[model samples]
Target chain A: MSDKSSSRSSGFDRRAFMAGAGIALVPLTARAAVQDPTQAAAQDPALPVEVTLRVNGQDKRLRIDARTTVLDALREHMGLTGSKKGCDHGQCGACTVLIGDRRVVSCLTLALAAEGQEITTIEGLATGDRLHPMQQAFIDNDAFQCGYCTPGQIMSAVACVKEGHAGSDEDIREYMSGNICRCAAYPNIVAAVKQAAPDIMKG
Target chain B: MRSFLYQRATDPGMAVQALSAAAAANNPLTQAAAQPLAGGTTLIDLMKLDVMRPAAIVDINPLARGWSGIETGGEKLRLGALAKMSDVAAHADIQRHYPVIANSLRLAASAQLRNMATLGGNVMQRTRCSYFRDTSYDNCNKRIPGSGCAAMDGVNRMHAVLGTSDQCIATYPGDFAQALIALDATVEITGKSGTRSMPFAQLHKAPGNTPDIETTLQPGELISAFSIPRRWPRSVYLKARDRQSYEFALSSAAIALDVQDGMIRDARVALGGVATVPWRAREAESLLKGQKFDDGLARRAADAAFADAKGRQHNSFKISLGKRLVARALQQASTMEV
Candidate 1:
């Protein structure tokens, strides 16, 4: 009877040991499972940024909380949607705009640092219905497919061609490498840039 | 996407004062705070991703005092901190004389960025570590106060091997800064106290245990000028990237030489994209000094640059790349009839 009782107690202890082990690991498993990607993304501590961006031709005070990109401000706050947002990052040229007169990745620029400067978005590229010369050449060459990356590609193309970077095919290729047309319309884009060089040069 | 506050200062002093106040306010009991606003090309992007959320931004571009002019006189060229990348690159004086500075700016991010960005802003921009950039999870001491550096061992293809410590390994990402360092440039800065001038080589510090402190820019200080002494015989800036333009360098070289009588009287060379700071290649400079500019001399100098390049597993490619950059930079400089 004593021996049987001891064996039964040992069995109870084994069950208790297993239960304790399982309980200890539950938090670790939960920790991994509960890690939210968005939450994880905001791990960096927050700092406030206040900037005044001179855009298109206006000086406006911007005190942005949660960090506002020049691209977001141009499209979201200012309601200028001509500059498309493809990759929110700096990889794609979909969000290209001019800070002073040169092309830059607006998506990468902080709206706070844009004070006292002229910003020219795609909407600013035309006079009423007349497009910039490069924009017209792009239309003539059908240099876009879905038109998602057109504004940025056009802006970059204008900058490249106008800057006399089209001195040679290699030079043009080197300069235009910044803009990527995922639609695979590179040949037409290059041709349109070449076509618009003279008018762009004069301008 | 979240809520925050913004403030703009009328000038640089106000900006610095605001920054000092906010930075000091780092919730001594909670977390760190405040950052100065420049061109916002790098920091703002991270903020949108919700990576950074400082309580306030001190507007610094208002410092008209920060932006000045290019003065060519007294054996050195002085570039005002406010000189736009485009302006500096397009300057007849800079291009005709210091081609390295012009070339570095020409190969920077993009034309639009050149117009928006100041020379001072480019030098002060943060590291380009993927982990530091990601709005999501990754180990980067620079981004997080002390989150433990995940990049020290993992996916460190772009991490620095030289001038790096166990606490941090992110590579410095400025093209023009290296050229400035090679040409023996000095950054001129002014603060609430006064003004200071230091060699560009000493501007950046190695990522010791304290990865948070990148430079010695004093509180309420603003860079006013970048000065380069004249008398360089030949100079070039060569950068190798995944593509041609508008991308950060994978590896790059900057070299300025004063050669005479089939021998180098003075030589200065610097390397970027491989170290924690603008790395001036002194051994290589020494090797090429008093020697003819030739393939043999170039190789010998190239060897000197890699002698101390201790790379991590993923970035061992930098060693070979650094060698190539040195050779290419030397070759390009040699061809220039200065």
Candidate 2:
């Protein structure tokens, strides 16, 4: 499920791009020593911040720009590209991921703020070739066409069921409204969620 | 997105101290040098669009442990500012006692956003006005003061009708805020100079002369919690939009009625998506206070609510739509099973 090739094809390496842009990799504590620190700090918005994110049961340390969102951290830095970036804004739910027990759009979540929390992308859902119930349900129901929004839809659906919002088809549709299926696979997506709700709830 | 220095604050005092450095600047609230990051739904999105470029971002999620509570045991409902919209909306007590608040949160955005967006951040969330959001159009008074408002003539359908000024007409885009204002909630603020409380209605400033300054909060001040005086189980929120879900309201109404033996004792009316702030329909509330719930009274109340509304070329329909919504919301609240 990891789209390493797609990540590479998307653009230049983030670290290399940052370096080429002449951004200073200043240590976080170093800002305190500067005279008129407020003015000095205000002038430098590109300072790199070190963050340790616990993704899929493993801790990954990243020294990236503070502006990096969880979506970029997962895709560009950690090579976990299952979560798509349909809209970098919160409008689209393609970047949805589980931060703790709740689902959130990763694009709006800053990587630096996500430290010490357990982050779960779509790639983390399955266990050793066994597809997660929601993912399997999506396939069984033909919940996707172009498959661009599958990962986010599945992630959102898993949360929706766990959140106890998948009791009815109307409830499922309302709960899953965030993840827009540009391919218009909503009916199938709702079916997939319905098919998986009982199993998900049982677990 | 421009670069920013990120620092995590373990406590409220630490967060204020970190933000205090940039608080001294005379910049507008939106352009504050340091911003407290709660849900990041607004801040990060605007940052990505280059609409907000704070020099520092203080991650205040660690303070959520102390600030995310939804306490209902007291005489007043004390909702911590950091409480997630979904958490508050789903809480049994909130749903049962404050249905307007719950429904407002539920009807807002998507499930994922509600899961992430904090109550404080939800109120602070900026407008969905395309001109203000997209930096390519450099004529937004809200984004740049005295520049101009392109939405005044171009694509003014989503613009505000009730609180429009010559300067700006960007609507306040959050549903939860209408609920707060309708309930007469009081906001508790924690800042560099300790804490202070104010009426939630006063938090947002209408786009008068200066559209840039959105809130009345001084630099380094953060909304710690909101206190509603009492619970109205008869309250309801009705939103009218293009879609059934995951869309901003075209016109929404939050109504809380105190009806005893079929006569209205008290009424609270607030409108959303049609005003620059969470609009409290005082005239409508005054009309409904002593009147019995009826279609005629509802129509009169709705008319009074929008009597002062000034709509532009494209958004003039909001005046009528807002009136209908207010009436419908009042009708629903009056008859709702408590």
Candidate 3:
């Protein structure tokens, strides 16, 4: 997981981005790094450490503080904000992501520890223009309400089907208990998982 | 959230050496100086909340090659410390031989957490007591050491009713530890000096005057593996909670029984969610020796388990709920098709 040489480059790039972004110069990379003042406060106020993550299928180098969670790294640093941070603790599954094909809470996962690991976020679930079958199923079934938790729910549901825990309604509910829906759209969520289970299992 | 140094240990010996060096230099007096990071489920969460602050964190996942196996080949089952909870729970051999272990792990946390949390980390995880986690509460003895225990007189419905001290009433939160104590598991430790093993039951100390000193493990000591003497095929874990899933137990029981001719030949009973430690009900187990494994005997044994239990205002229900769980777990284990 340690790319000894690129660590220095990523640190240099982040400093450059911070310097440019803080000066009101909207460079493409700077714009991507600083979303808002809150995001800037969460990202730039801490000590930056270089970490490498094999995100989706590609190795992405980043400069973040030791405190930046995997969820925040993807959202704040990498500009892939599909994964939501609901509770920021492990209590809610809104920050769920695939680490080496196993689902885990990204909100509780430190980016420093996630080095050299395969991280599949919701944005990585789809190919070119085609939606992943699970994403298609969520849309078809209207499985979400406010949609804040959809990315995490879909990520976990995809894992649930792959893990063979979507055999029945009760099974799906038990396995998907991690991804809590405040909309209480659980019936449709279960239906979406059941609908997508066969196709997910085939893959 | 505080900025701390992070180092990945290439091996168990290196991990010990790093922690020993840090402890010897920084705080030679306390056991909480340096912590080993496994799954980071508990340590990271507590750190995020500012509940726990360690000088350095040694990433121990690299040591998994030496300590992450699930071996069920011998008379005793050997489980490495780095084995994920989900992997251990779903292992075919563990499922068949030790259902209590499997059930306890599978039922403890959510599926995502089970996938991320490690066996050693789970056993070493801290309590879910609100008073301990929230810094706004200034009276948690477990967190601040002699300030006070707010849970004693506050909303303590989730607090321990057994194995509690006047100083602290926080409950031991993990479920798998109950199964470990029930099956007489042993913890293998790797420390700065060398390696040694101890009974799993001896790992956690009761919450006496020094509630701060939770475990008997010395500074810079890391748990390497857990070994169980024998399989309890007729074993089961039953947890009662406020919700059906992803919630900490209100009361739970782990039971293993050896029965012959409708009589219990040997039994092991442990209680969770109602104790200061993973409590072994030795008196209750002795009460069932040579007795018919019936409802009456189970109830009597369950009663014996909680005879010395004392409860506070909101937690008195745990005593009764705990007794019922003991009886129910006994009934389930005794009737298993072993």
C-alpha RMSD values across all candidates: 13.0, 3.6, 7.2
The lDDT leader among the candidates is 2
- Model 2 root mean square deviation, Cα atoms: 3.6
lDDT of 3 by residue, B1-338 (tens): 65555667777777777666666443322236567889999988887777777756677888889899999996689999999999999998999999999999999889999998999999988988989988889998788878999998899999998999999999999999999999999999999778999999999989899888788887778999999999889999999999899989999999999888987889999999999999999999999988888899999999999999999999999999999999999988888898
Residue-wise lDDT of candidate 2 within B45-95, one digit each (tens)?
Answer: 787777888877777888999999888996589999999999999999999
Model 2: lDDT equals 0.87
**Each prediction's Cα lDDT score?**
0.73, 0.87, 0.85
> Per-residue lDDT for A62-130 in model 1, tens only?
543234578877886778898887766566778888766578888766565555578888877787898
- For all predicted structures, in order, the TM-scores are 0.83, 0.94, 0.91
Pairs in steric clash, model 3: none
lDDT of 2 by residue, A1-203 (tens): 11112222222355577789896556653222223435545544455556789999999988766667899999989999999988778777999999999999998888877778899999999999999999999999999999998999999999999999999999999999999888999999999999999998889
Which runs in model 3 stand beyond 4 Å of their true positions? Answer: A1-47, B24-31
lDDT of 3 at A129: 93
The TM-score obtained for chain B of candidate 1 when compared with the true chain B: 0.92
Docking quality (DockQ) of candidate 2: 0.43
Off by over 4 Å in 1: A1-70, A77-79, A109-118, B1-4, B25-32, B64-66, B231-233
Task: Rank by TM-score, highest first.
Answer: 2, 3, 1
Q: Rank the candidates by lDDT, best first.
A: 2, 3, 1
Q: Please tell me how candidate 1 rates in CAPRI terms.
A: incorrect
Top candidate when judged by DockQ against the true structure: 2
